[model samples]
Target: MSINIDIRLKKACKIFREGENISGLILLQTNSDVKHDGIFLTMEGAVNLQLSSKTVGIFEAFYNSVKPIQLVQYTVEVVPAGKIPSGKTEIPFELPLKPRGNKSLYETYHGVFVNIQYMLRCDIKRSFLAKGVSKSLEFIVEDRRPVKKTDREQSKAVSFRIKPESLQNTRDKSNVPRFCISGKIDSLSCRLSDPLIGEVVIESCETVIKSVELQLVRVETCGCAEGYSRDATEIQNIQVGEGNVCTGLAIPIYMVFPRLFTCPTLSTSNFKVEFEVNLIVVFEDDYLVTENFPIILTRH
Candidate 1:
């Protein structure tokens, strides 16, 4: 006979805070009566790190540095060895969200080189002659506390003017197209719950403006005392202007931080997660001018 298994969370969104309990149910459906050894449920959270291609060979000797760190793990038997009738059966379960030993629960983040994840797994043990069935479900974890008022009050807005002369890494200044752009970010320190707010204006340009885009980037660092691997990757890109024709027109800047892909600015002994924003202006000839801003993210 065949058995179908599914896992559902109490919260439709499957999001939990640091100290909240993870409550869910397991649904089992079978065409006929089935016998099982037992039903087991396990909750696990971990932080996985990997070295970039450029740093992989360098850390080959210290492979453990990139090993996954277990933050939490709990397993319990939900049902004793018994027989279940045909049709559907629901088994409820609740697991406390607590860190193991001295480890602390960090916000769930999905990045290129670093990832924090929490999963719930259910296993149905069967006889030696029969195959066992299992299922896994993922959930999100967020910080319990918000950013302090002091930190928010201290946040300062930053203004900048981007011109050919202001651009960096240009081998020849004369070759760069003449352009003038100005913008002001409301604040360099931003809350994870709110959208990033800013405004930009195109003052003048010698060449036709092709596109204006805002790129959110994530900087992940992982390593130990011997060495460290740091990499920056783009998380999302939003186009604010396309085929720009008018000059001196203000363009609003707004971007929502995507969950699971971003977390509060974090720095630990083993790893660090930071963020940055790049304002890019592309010309008709494909030449682009970029201005970068390092931003601090908070839980508030």
Candidate 2:
């Protein structure tokens, strides 16, 4: 006889927050009567950090590995089965998802070098010598932090000024060589679905600007005592200006943050996720100028 298993949540929504209760039902189907020792279900959730060494050194490459740092994990038994002689059977369950003390749940994130995920898994126990049925589902955990209102006077515009002479010796010189790009974001906070409005001004007579683009970058930091690594991904890129842009020129920038690829800023003891607006300017001389402005994202 063939066996099938299905999971259904009471809310029918996979999205949940901290301190929330997850209630669901497990459905089992069989073509004919079957006997089993017992039935058990397990639910596990945690943050997995996988790191790799990009260096060509043999020792460094050999040490690279995937390290799963657990944020929270819990398991429970579902049912004690005796015998099954039915076409369909249902098992109900409830699980509590709680964040650590004074800690918040981070939004689900995925990147080339890093990923933060939360998943629920269900396993069915079968007799020995037979493979057990298993299934897993991914969910989103969002943290809703209280945002302090900004004063009317301080909400005008947030400006970013980058100068080549003021850069420190440890800074990467290849990004900002001989040009200054100053920009202003309309506000310091924005919703994930809202559009970000800003303006940029380029000032440099020696360098000929070839193109200017705006990028929505997500910076994910993950580690725990062993070592820490941070990676940034350009989620969205928009061309705002092109051609010779020198001798004082202004460009207007507008970009909409997508909900699928973007997440609100969050921080935990194990990891943190942050978002920023980056302005990249390429000059004819092959030099580049990058200016970044930090912005907070909220759920609408």
Candidate 3:
């Protein structure tokens, strides 16, 4: 007899979040009456980081290996594996998705170097020489919290300034800057659903000011020969000046963080994930100035 299985979630989409209920139905169909040792289902969530190093040193290279780290994990058994009669059967389940107290549930992340995921597995136990059937489903989990006044105090605004002569002294590029940008954000701690608000002041250089931009950058690091790397995407941009920038000019800053793509800053022994606010300045000579401030993204 042919057997088939499918999972049905109470919600329309498979999307879910922490501190939420996960309730669903397991549908089983068979062409004829089927008997089994038992049937079971399991739900699991985990964060795994793997690092391999072959270039750390000759001795380390000889013993190069991947290290696995589990940042979060949750599991539950839905049904204990014996069953028979079946044209179709439905088994329902309800489970809370949060981990233990004080342990934050990380957002689902999949990277070339690290992975965080959640899933459900179903197994049909069979007797004799028959093989047991199994199936699995993956879901997205987002974790967000309310921001408190205490969280605001943890982030401090960073400020800096630029001079026109600083741009001309390319001879001492290491010490001189073309333009100086100084600003104060409302707070460095932000939510994925909240707007980032701040003000920026620019000191004009010899060249005409083109535009100013803000970027949300994600940096992922692993214990590898290259160490760590970064990816930056523009969040917002506007023209603050046309000709030379006038000193003491205030430019208002506003940007909404995307809820679906942004992940909170996280760190582990073998891997680290972080987010930052980047300010980019462009001049007529194609001269550019960039300033960065480390920021923490939290649900709360």
Candidate 4:
């Protein structure tokens, strides 16, 4: 009897944010004569963060800076060591990352997140042994939020990230999609005139007939949380804010992203990253929020 075993990742091409969950399916097809206990599937990772500073002032004072970020990875699996007839099967797994409190700054401890990788193999000496196929994924990340207000004036700011990533040797990219401001709202926080899950608006004054459109602002990229950790710098950040407004008012905004494409690279990764600190005013009504940051990328 003869049999064929092929595994393919079905949902691996979807977009993902850092703070959220990563779920996917693996399809297995077999037709000939084969017997294996249980099939196998796995998730692996390789992380890196790099930073550098360039100074330009009076003959080399302080001018500018640049940083680098990269990741290299692959996956494999194995099945039970037995043999039997042929059939089809599917497997699923979730890949999760810890919440990074800050970027790679201060010291080289927090900014750089490198984890051990795993390997999975499937073999049936009497059947088929597939252990030589692999794929590569490379992508960039960056986002932010800012707020400032006064008794008479209100200022608001917003920030996010975008750059096509190179994955599986295929360049699938997303554009500079605006963070439209989408989020959940508590029923108790709703007023008669306000709809739940509304747009982020600056409405403290009556003179302007309309509220201002807030764009993501660039704060301190590669900023250290101070004494907690140290880093070389590629960690990026962006922020958005509005001027002075009332002291006890609340504001909300939704996060929006561009449509998905054929490539595995995601355009806006809001849930998967860690962001900290802002000089702007943050409202009390914020049940949940997503931020974006910008970064410099070079294709090799």
lDDT of 2 by residue, 157-256 (tens): 8877767765545366656557666778897687766788888888663567788889898887765555556777789899998877755666888998
What lDDT does model 3 reach? Answer: 0.66
Off by over 4 Å in 4: 1-13, 34-40, 48-79, 83-87, 95-300
Q: Against the true structure, what is every candidate's RMSD?
A: 1.7, 5.0, 5.5, 16.8
For each candidate, the alpha-carbon lDDT, in order, equals 0.90, 0.70, 0.66, 0.29
Q: Write the residue-wise lDDT of candidate 3 on 1-300 in tens digits.
A: 777888788987877888788889988898778778777776677666543343245334222323544434454556654564668888897877776546666787765445677787777888878888788888778766555566577666645554544343356675443556677777788776688888888744444677777777666665545343333344445444455557678888887776445666676544576777777787766677766777888865
lDDT of 4: 0.29
Model 3 spans with C-alpha error above 4 angstroms: 1-4, 11-21, 29-37, 50-66, 71-88, 96-107, 126-133, 140-151, 155-160, 163-171, 174-183, 199-205, 208-211, 223-252, 284-286
Cα lDDT of model 4 by residue, 1-300, tens digit: 444444333334443334444445444455754555444443333233222223112222111111122222233444455544467655565545223344321111123322112222333344245333223232222211111122113112233221123112323323222222222222211111232232333333222111222332212223122211122223222233344343234455432221110011111121112222212223333211233223111111
TM-score per prediction, in order, is 0.95, 0.73, 0.67, 0.27
Give model 4's clash tally.
58
- Counting clashing residue pairs in each candidate, in order, gives 0, 0, 9, 58
Q: Write the per-residue lDDT of candidate 1 for residues 125-244, one digit (tens) a residue.
A: 999999999999999998766676655764788899998898888989999888899989998888889999999999999989999999999999999888888899999999999997
What are the clashing pairs of model 3?
38-81, 38-82, 39-81, 145-299, 145-300, 146-300, 147-300, 161-180, 162-180
For lDDT, the strongest prediction is 1
In model 1, where do residues sit more than 4 Å from their true spots?
A: 146-154
lDDT head-to-head 2 vs 4, winner: 2
